[model samples]
Target: MAWLLVLQGCAGWQSALDPKGPAAGELAWLIWFFTGLCAVVWVLVMVALVAPLMMRSPARSEPLALDAGAEHRKVRLVVTAVGVTALILVGLTLLSFFANRTLAAIGSDAALTIRVTGHQWWWEVRYEAAQPSRILTTANEIHIPAGEPVRLVLTSTDVIHSFWVPSIAGKLDLIPGYVNVLDIKADKPGVYRGQCAEFCGAQHANMGTFIIAEPRPQFDGWLNDQLRAAAAPTSADAKAGADLFLKRACVMCHRIGGTVAGGTVAPDLTHIASRQTLAAGTLTMSRGNLAAWIADPQGIKPGSHMPVVDLDGDELNAIVAYLEGLK
Candidate 1:
């Protein structure tokens, strides 16, 4: 029953054992192979331990004498066990080296490169193209083309953080003032949840993101949608809301692509309404949730850099209304 539960835990969307990509599949294979080999070694050791106990004992009259032939056999057994352990260790080391080589090569021919910068608790995902018009930047959520390798250039602006989406690839650390390259690909279209595997700071547990893999055409369409600016307000309420948002303190940290409210300190809100989650995956993206977050960011993510923007009932409603229409 306990083993069954253990296996059940391994079959989730966030489980390393339930691999959905080539990198993760290789890792899972390594894990199971090493575990099985270790189990076999353990069983052999147990048999060796119990073999002496099962052997016939000499009579007390024999005066506890050690047989020369038995002593020779014992020494030979010890030497053989040591030799076997050394061989296993060497084998595992070589296996690790080859596995790492394979993983590194997985992204060597990658056509798409994504620059992922780790903020205090959020992810700034940037897709860069040769042409300036093709570049796109979004926060927290990332959508990639399925069945294609993508190279991720990872870095951190603050403390150390680790990016991990277990079903897709292994965890990689995000060191401050430095960068690391990781290559990942999804075998099929699905949404995979990822979280910071390193202990960053307060609200670390709430720092979540998603990797959505879709068909190439769908992904291209999504990118094109994100590249467009926020649509103009069609209704009176939306226009009033938009007016209040730019006039208030809301423009200090966020940026709206089409508008003049360009602040680079926080997440880009150009197409925030299209995002699936708010506050870095803490809440669902909705009018109520967006209002709650804008009103009190600390309540949703304590220790976050987002400061509280005091807004009256109408002011808050207008701001939330404007943000909700950014899609």
Candidate 2:
């Protein structure tokens, strides 16, 4: 009995009850309201349980001997009225609360805008309006400043997608031509996991991303760094690798700074070294992982849009060096 009460008190329901990000405190209040409702419901249920045990007359065994029709009708009418009233009150209260809270949250004005465009199985994040025509595109990685309200303007290129970071806020749909805005924030600096909530395609299960909330100064610095275009490799091996990258099959579906290979199908390798992970946030951006992914992309992610590139040992090493020097 005590354990049941404890479980009720500590409801582990995701999103609705247990919140983790900026909206967490606001959602905490909402959970309290629901908890109060549970208390009332529990009390009513107890009364309903006890009433039968206490009021079950001894004459009930011999229904034909007693005047049970009128009493039964009266009891039924009272129970129906009470049940209807209780349900109506609960519904009204919940509706009013939902409207009030949702309106207040949506009406908030001072929020920074982030345009998040969904790709086949990855997210193309950009900081809009900060700079004109200078779009800083990153794949499957969203970095923002902590302690500031940020609104994501979501849209998809192909199928319907959903941007959901359980620890941050609720899921918002990404539809083609229609931009849905989701207001979110973080109080502390950490990396939170996110996933595409809607079923997209074969690689939908692998559609995951990370949200990194940094302090104001750090975030600003990162933003500035991303704004700058990719730089050329300095080392001999890296320079050789850059030439090989341009001459090879990678030029068809990828882009780099000041390069003719301006294909938009794949992620931009402008600053690939600065990124924590690669291949739409699937593999860690290490030398070994990069080598393997470049060798056989289908092996890493079966339905990936990127195809394998056949390069010689020296050429592969040089390409790796050039990519690693992108930071």
Q: Evaluated with lDDT, which candidate comes out highest?
A: 1
lDDT of 1 at 173: 92
Candidate 2: pairs in clash:
241-318
**Could you give candidate 1's per-residue lDDT for residues 1-327 as a string of tens digits?**
222222232225578998999999989999998999999999999999999999997576677677899899999999999999999999989888988988898898899999888888899999989999999989998899999999999999988999998999999999989989999999998888788899999978877878889999999999999999888887777888899888877688888999999987789999999988876777877788788888888877889998987779987887777788898
lDDT of model 1, residue 302: 84
- RMSD for each of the candidates: 4.0, 6.7
- Candidates' TM-scores? 0.94, 0.82
Q: lDDT per residue, candidate 2, 1-327, as tens digits?
A: 222222232224234345555566566565676678778768877887797788756546765775779679868968996987789688858866874576347427634678888888888887776458556776677888887778888999999999987667767899998989888877677766678999999888777777788998999899888878788789999999988888887888788867777867778788888877776667777898888888888988898888878888888888999999888
Model 2 regions more than 4 Å off: 1-18, 24-56, 60-62, 65-107
* Model 2 lDDT, full chain set: 0.76
For model 1, the local distance difference test gives 0.86
